[model samples]
Target chain A: MNEQLSMRQIVFMYLFISLSPVLRQIPTALADESGRSGYLSPFWSVFLILPLASIIILLIKSFPSLNLYEIMVHLIGKVFAKLIITLYLVWIIVFLTAKMNIYSLTLQFTLMPKTRSDFFMQIMLILVFYALLRGSKTIFRFSEFSLGPILLLIGILFACAITRLRTDYLLPVSTINLPSTIKASTSVIAVGGNMIIALFFADKLGISLTKKQVKKFWFGAIFFIIFSFVITVFTFGITGAGLTARLPFPFYITVKSISFFNIFERFEVIVTLICILSDFITICISFIILMKLIQWLFGLEQVWFCFLPLAIIVYYFSYFLSSTQFEFNFLYRYIIVNMNLLFQYIIPFLLGLICLLKRKYIKKQY
Target chain B: MIYIFGGLLLISFIKQKDVILNKKRNLVLFLLLSVCGIALGTVHMISPYIPSIAYSLEGILRTLLVNR
Candidate 1:
């Protein structure tokens, strides 16, 4: 009903959705083994840089009132617009579903082995659905309310883990070759690619984002990247890269390793909660976009009608995926690499360029 | 647990017959979308179990991107 979101809410939504605690652990855990052939070591740094660059570019190319969707439609004709959007929607759904599956799988593996995957997934879907049903404003409100606690939890984990951090892990960081480093930057792009969601919200939030807010978003993103970098560096440093590379969810493994004079142990629970909440926010943002795309494309009135089917599809997908770790690896390495690069990066970039050229041509005629 | 919760949510709405029928067309449309959502979810979950499905989709996508 309402097209615009508040400035403060936009900030909250961006922070909440961007952090994506759950999948954060996966890159480090999965990177080394999943053909990091082209990627560099101390992988986090390269990952951080790519997103930093992407966000900077996006901010500079600010559009007046159009979100990414409208801009794409305006730039391209209706047919191309539909094609691009359909491709984007599929990617968004797959990405969201993979995340949900990962969250459900992690919970099963770590916290509640006795529970069925279907059970955990359904609960997650309900929570996300509730958030989705409330619409973007409520979702942003939830983010605003939850942001502090989530940040605090992350802060505590970082603080407690610091004493265990070895600075030597960062040393010789510059040694990674340029080609490999550039290749590794793709991982960062993949992770940080979520920032593209900003285009969706820009118009809705009516964000004439101050230099300060833009700076804040980048600052937060950089901080997350650095935090993840430090955690991964020390984790590999302490555990040895060989051992660290073998374990999935290396961050969780690192959290599990934390101890305070025998007074504190098994801090993984806190870490898991952080991961779940972050992923939930990510899924919520994806769902919002999906709903909006459906409404805009079909000229539909009510958005809530769109939620149930989407939720059901996500739920079933989460349950039926990878019974073993090998399948998971295959999906990531072969399946996601191609699918994500095409839909997330190439098509959008091409569409954006075509739209820009078309606008220029139309203007000249006028 | 999810079924319980989702079912309850659905039931609460169903009880308000006027609300459900008032937007009957939208409700039908939503239900159809729900089926698609369920299919997508099912495909994702089963993709792992049936390696061929993953391979086929990936293969199709790869070809599309490459050809383009």
Candidate 2:
């Protein structure tokens, strides 16, 4: 089995991971900020996602066969790279905890409303631990195989919901809302920032990418924008922007109204199951990255020694991070989004700037 | 629940005893993380009613950003 991950697989993994945020956060965040024009925010995010995607590709192209940490070391030197890695460490831990909190909260809101969050966390950790034991490639392969069906299901729901779309809810977009749409697009941009995960796996990509591989990167970015657009459109179209803003999970509600020829009802269960699967993959990827960061930070040979303890920490912090949905919502809206922008976009932009400046020296070293 | 957590930690410590004894850095890293996890878990277990750290941070951030 070739454990070396292809660029296409990385794109698949990213799309898989971005599903939860696309489902849970983007629609409501956009609706709250942009009103009826919120659905346009996904399109607005194209300005940032394209550049972020290009920067990721450039970083991989410039520092071929190097992981993010190593690329940082080459571009900015070791001390600053370690400092940046430490910042990533903090960001990832909080991000992981937040994901866990949302996973349990989503379940509580949708299915098994009575179950303690601790039970969900415990079960999720066990599954994540098992996945980690299978190695990183397996996780990527799982996403590669699963993304197709998930997208197909979402497509079917969209087809079913097309008739139910209220044109009044989405139409009459005055010029005034464009600015707010751009602002609200930050939610989409924040979610799309998960593209930087490519750098984490760059070392496994081997040296040099073909044109086809490059196309996959752009394909992933384009797919993200389209996916976000369609999901938001469906939510706004079916559920209406006002209701979407008020509801926590508007896509779930939007799906509830869809039935195949009035025969297959309660498609919301499929939505719930997809969200759960996305959350599981998201958590698994976060753990892999978290352990990788720890290994890089401490110069440790084997990260397995730290995995159990880290899982325990995440288990407890999941509870400590946000005890209720309201707190989680607040944190997500303000702190997490901004933090993601910093780590995912700004830092990578700066790194890319430095990489261009030091290109000559880097070539000499390699 | 706390006892169960402790039991799992103990089982982990036992299973990794070879690396714990041989590798100094791994041992230190392992111990530090385990201690932090145990302490946080115990704190949450002991005072389940206390407001979460996020709630506190949210209050502070909201005050600073919104109120001001």
Candidate 3:
């Protein structure tokens, strides 16, 4: 693992991952859950992420100068560590396919209805495989350079599009049942918990992570999540809740609705650029993390061997994961969201607890 | 399809010939995962559907949802 990095690089990588391809669905899901005052969904979801991120931070601190996989192996037994790593392998496979399916669905609905989605998945995975082979440092470096410009474009677009939101729709927080609202906002876990992926490669970040830094990242993530929510709500809030629930890609539609001086109505390209850049980084970063975990599990010295095989598996599985939009949405709403909670929060919390309780004599077991 | 997977396996094996030939355990582990990938890929190519963790769980959940 390469070990030369600054705080800025780490922060930017987390920011990009925290705001991801799945963000487009959040507002609509929130609207469906919380009804008219759907905007609060981001708040609910991000709120849950703070504690989860904190747990992961503590879990990482427990094991000295180790990556997430090493931390797991130390805290838990080897067999359990393998089980968790295997689960993450399955988890990331679903993550890639979910994003691929959704991106494909987004394209089919918007730009290229005639093109096969499998084509896009294959191309995207191939590019990601190349980046994964190049390794995490290169991807994080690209993230550092891209973050400034992408954030600026996102800010400008948010300013232009948000002016169209009706204050009336944004006033109330939520009028629905509590359980439904929580359920709707579960996707926030996906974004906020993404920082935990960075911990998997923490040894490469050079500096030992601190509580203060984790707090800073949480604040930074909250700021980004708030910005994302505003756009999501404005897109759905001003357009009416029914339309938000109707459209799969309401944020894209919101960008389409933006028209400055009646000249620049088609500003969806900015949204597309942000989505594509983030998706590219996200898919590659995910594969890198998965490959690292596989290496740790199998005691393989060479990760290059596992890279092509796992990438091919991801590519093939992407084709068969979800055949229709309904299946995709159902999987996201029920299965993936719940699973995200289990792995992101429950598992990390367990590890953290074990770290606290275990005596000092429990030296490095691996 | 066989030839394509065969070519990938042979080429990767050739590239890492020293590591593959030197350690039998490493070779077994490498071949096991690679063959699994190839089998899944080939099945996906030939059939309309291939079994996956995502869809299997989806089916299980859907069944639960329908039953409930």
Candidate 4:
């Protein structure tokens, strides 16, 4: 508990947690739905990149201390601050519940169909509960510990997949219409919006990011963008856009298509493990944020009080959606799009503007 | 199955009483809350009640503020 994460560990945590396993199936899901909608083209996909850049820039400017909540309080009045913070906390809880449901449902459908949904959720909740109990420093340490092996595995998988790549699949990329292309960019942005969790840890993470650290973080973000783009391109190229858009786990299918000496036949398991690990990390981060936000909002001396309520909320809500398809469709079509804009983009931008205005007013008074 | 795990976790809490009362209290509370959660989960399984409530509230708010 006394251990603090070094800057390297913090950077690694951010990188690994941002490009999480939950994202592996995301491209497939998005491409499947959005591609048909003619929104998978690169032209519009770039819009998706802006909000992440905007959020990161906002964090970098406000850095060293002051989380989104603390910053809101400083910029806005206490009443508005409390109101906004409460809404954000509810959003986080709902978002986390949705994610938990998705992951659990995905696992139930694909890997362990026989397992009861409640059982899967309970196990996940226990893991998240344990992770949250250990606190953020421990979570960061775990990230540091797991980052190396995970990266190495991912590297190997990527290397293997590259050998089987077909460049021809990437052809006719320019054929996508302008409107469709633009919408695809928003999908990419929505995917990248996962990085906003960085804000939850930004305050405790210590703000003094050196030029090197900033460069490294940006490098990681660039790496993630390129990685995603490559995976999409390759999957599309190999499977064809139409087929790629239809596969639920297209990247996994891409991995499945790879055979090195026919010995490495089942690489989908590796993808599954990676996805589960990433999901675990994300859920842990979400749980920690929930606990911290609750404590902050309620002015509670103990953070643990928030955990029970959170666990209960997550547990029950996980079962609320009748099926995996419902969870996936609801999340992608409605929840993520709206939540990403409102909470991730609009709220933060508004708060940052309010801070700027407040500063100017104070300066004028002086 | 959830109840069994919950029971075991509860037992672990009982065994760890010497660690810290504060920690024990939290474990007990979490276990109790999870019990309530299981009940809620069962209720949800039976009815699409919660989302309907959320939707209605959202609809009302949207209607009062602006056209949805």
Could you say which candidate leads in lDDT?
A: 2
Compared with the true structure, what per-residue lDDT tens digits does model 3 show for residues A273-337? 67777878878777777777777777877667666667666666666777667778777777777
**Candidate 2: misplaced stretches above 4 Å?**
B65-67
Q: Write the per-residue lDDT of candidate 3 for residues B1-68, one digit (tens) a residue.
A: 44555687778878887876776767887788787777777877798565554567778877999999
* Top-TM-score structure, candidate number: 2
**Residue A305's C-alpha lDDT in candidate 1?**
50
Stretches of model 4 off by over 4 angstroms after superposition? A1-11, A20-25, A33-51, A54-60, A359-366, B1-39, B45-68
Clashing pairs in 3: none
* Candidate 1, RMSD to the unseen true structure: 5.2
Fnat score for model 1:
0.43
What would the per-residue lDDT of candidate 4 be over residues A103-128, giving only the tens digit for each residue? 77667645787986667777787888
Evaluated at residue A222, the lDDT of candidate 1 is: 62
Model 4 chain A lowest lDDT segment of ten? A36-45
Q: Which model, 1 or 3, shows the larger TM-score?
A: 3
Clash pairs (backbone) in predicted model 2: none
Q: Write the per-residue lDDT of candidate 1 for residues A226-286, one digit (tens) a residue.
A: 6455455546545555555566566677778777566988887877777778778878887
Tens digit of lDDT per residue, candidate 2, span A241-284? 99999988989998988899998899888898999999999999
Query: Between candidates 1 and 3, which one is better according to DockQ?
Result: 3
- TM value for model 3: 0.89
**Which portions of model 3 miss their true places by more than 4 Å?**
A171-179, A210-212, A359-366, B1-6, B49-66
Please provide TM-scores, in order, for all candidate models, with all chains considered together: 0.78, 0.98, 0.89, 0.80
